[model samples]
Target: MAKKKSNVVNLDERKEAKAKASSGNSMMVSIMNMTKRIEELKTEKQKICEMAARTILKALDAKDKYTYGHSMRVTYFSMVLGKELGLNDQEMYDLQLSALFHDIGKIGTPDAVLNKPTRLSDEEFKIMKKHPTESYEILKGFSVFEKVARFAKHHHERYDGRGYPDGLKGEQIPLYSRIILIADTFDAMTSTRVYRKGLPYQTAYDELNEFSGSQFDPELVVKFIRGMKKEQAKKEDKFYIPLMDEMYEKDAA
Candidate 1:
């Protein structure tokens, strides 16, 4: 009878151990499933954010075709400098956003000032100069655009503390902002506008050299010029913007 009891006890112990093992396996599966779901949620959120971003960009495009195209070129030029500076993936991404939206405030600009074929009056210029601050206001409203907004706001800031909206001087300006200003001026110089013919790339380079250390950071100016030369050597007449997923002509059309 004692031997019989021992055999029964061993069988019950085995059953208990098997049940515990099965429960542990079930718990592990549940955890993995939860983790996967969380990752999927994150991807979905990112897609939604991108969709919203594209929508805002389309609105900007509808507001001003010239500014839209100018922004694209600026993005390309900024990326050239960014690559030359060896920015990591995250920095490059942020730089691209900053450059692309640097002039987004122009969406609020009146057609009279934005598309005028003549030089702006001081009053009109004042209205025009409000763009950088306006850009900050628009972009800062989006959670993903924090750095982008700040950089755009400060892009017009001069190294000598003479820029409008803000007097941030030298390195007080975000590095990305400093880079965007160079690209912005470069595009403005190279793009043919209704007001006047575009300057030659060589002439633009000379102009940039003339203002270095006053309007631009001297070191960044050198990097931008060097990067642009390499870009020209590639002999490609078009550049790509990852956000728009589009290629644009190097020269103004």
Candidate 2:
């Protein structure tokens, strides 16, 4: 009887050991599967981000000829202004992104109105005002562009609340939007359109100052103008006419 009991006990011990070994293997397999899934998710996330950015750029390029590549240039200029204005990294990033999509709503505007050789008519002007709302609606699905969409919605909002869409006057409008507003306007003024020649830098600068009180945030306009002057001082040898010509050509095409 004692010998039989010992044999049974040994058998039970073997079973327990086997069970533990099996559990360990299962745990390892589970961990490996989880790790692989995480990697796959990361790859998919990156792909989606790339796709979204590309879609935005393509949409902008198709919106208008002159405005084609202007988003990125405005983004670069806004980043410079954001940095000079003491914005943090995240704030600067937001400004850059907002500037990139500031006119994304123009995607919904008719090409006739967008590319017209003459100024927009009152009826056309009314259509133009819908861009902010249209952009907001179009971008609502994208988490990446949510803040940028908000900025886009309000980029034209005047400091005094006269601007369209939300009309969120002054500080009520996001600071990032404010920065983009100045940057976008500056770039537009300096770049020619179908109906008009580009304003000279000095003339554009003066116009900015002239509109500071009503059209722009007074403090931000100062910062933007200062940054422009500093950039000009650094690139004094470059005529910039070629750059302007290329920019307008890209848009006109």
Candidate 3:
């Protein structure tokens, strides 16, 4: 066989390899910059969606006084109480969303029943009771908030299986639902409806105490009580009574 020429370079090939390595490093830098830019855009998109969602909620608030501020107060209480109970951030987020939507089913209720200055008739109340299920149906379609759907649907359930849409008793109820239930009841009791007056904080606390084990989770109630005590000690945490009264008075007027 005839000798073939060795076309491969020695030092020249090493220099070319070094050049390629530096080019690859530049390409990697470019890729990182692009990745960061994409993340920023994604973050901006999330902010926009969040703003839009809040705007929708605000619009809903304007249409319904009973719903508007009540939802926000429940959300704040639920989230703070959940955090005090040592729930994780994601769980707390779900609790807030659930609390905010717990009364959404009432949107399906007629204004006569929902905004009635007098006590609801049995039939009207029965129709009003369907709100939780209505809320669940409305929210379940949003797969992103499926967890919240359960919370809204079951918040009305009683610890002793007395409360409603479903008769789930005791531990059968989801903890998140149970949490919102406590918050919802607390806010509802402290807030005057068209047919009733707001209870004093002491009265509300006593009511919650009286209802424990039957109406609420005893352990959660204990945590709630402790949280309330701590909150009451803070100057900014004193909104439970005044805020409810003012809002409800406005509603009544």
Candidate 4:
């Protein structure tokens, strides 16, 4: 009877140990599954955000063809400076999106103010100046676009404390914003319009240099000019924008 009882106790101990090992293995598998699921969710969220960005860009295209093309050019120009600045991959990505969306708020402006061929009146200029704030409003709602929104909002700020909508000065402005502003002004000066011929690249460079430290960041202006000179030397007829999957001629009008 004693021997039989001991055998029963040993069997119970073995069964308990096996059960514990099985529970531990199950827990490990659950943890691994959760980790994989988390990674997948992150990828899915990124895709959704990208999709949203594309949709908004398309809407801008439909609203203003000129602005759409300008956005593409601005993005290209910003990337040139971004490369010269030795930005990391993620910084480059963020810079591209911020530049592309910087003028997106113009979509909400009245056509008279937005599409006027002549110089704007004070009222019209006031309306036009609201675009950066409008851009912030449009973009700040998205979790993925929070940083991009801030960059867009501050793109109009000057190196001096003279700019509008908050007047953030010098390095107080986001670096990406400062970079985009240079690119924006460059594109505006160099892009051909019905009323005026585009300035030569050198002429535009001179203009940027003239305003350095007053209207623009002095260091960034130098880097932008250097980078752009290299781009011009490439002598490539067409440049491709990866975000929109489109190609633009080097001197697109």
- Against the unseen true structure, what C-alpha lDDT does each candidate score? 0.90, 0.74, 0.76, 0.91
Q: Best candidate per lDDT, number?
A: 4
- The sequence of per-residue lDDT tens digits that candidate 1 reaches over residues 34-147 is 999998987687567667766776788897888888988999999999999999998998998889888988888999998888889999999999999998998888777888
Work out the TM-score per prediction: 0.85, 0.74, 0.74, 0.88
The alpha-carbon deviation from the true structure for residue 150 of candidate 4, after best TM-score superposition, in angstroms, is 0.5
Between candidates 3 and 4, name the one with more favorable TM-score: 4
Better of 1 and 2 by lDDT: 1
Q: lDDT ranking from best to worst?
A: 4, 1, 3, 2
Which parts of model 3 are misplaced by more than 4 Å? 1-56, 193-196, 237-253
Could you give me the TM-score of model 4 versus the true structure? 0.88
Best-first order by TM-score: 4, 1, 3, 2
* Model 1: lDDT to the true structure: 0.90
Q: Give per-candidate clash totals.
A: 0, 2, 0, 0
At residue 122, candidate 1 shows an lDDT of 97
On lDDT, the stronger of 1 and 4 is 4
Q: Which 10 residues in a row give candidate 1 its minimum summed lDDT? A: 45-54
Error of 1 at 245 (Å): 1.2
Model 2 C-alpha lDDT per residue in residues 113-139, reported as the tens digit of each score: 887887789999999889878777766
Question: Distance from true position, residue 85, model 2, in Å?
Answer: 1.1
lDDT (0-100) at residue 188 of candidate 3? 78
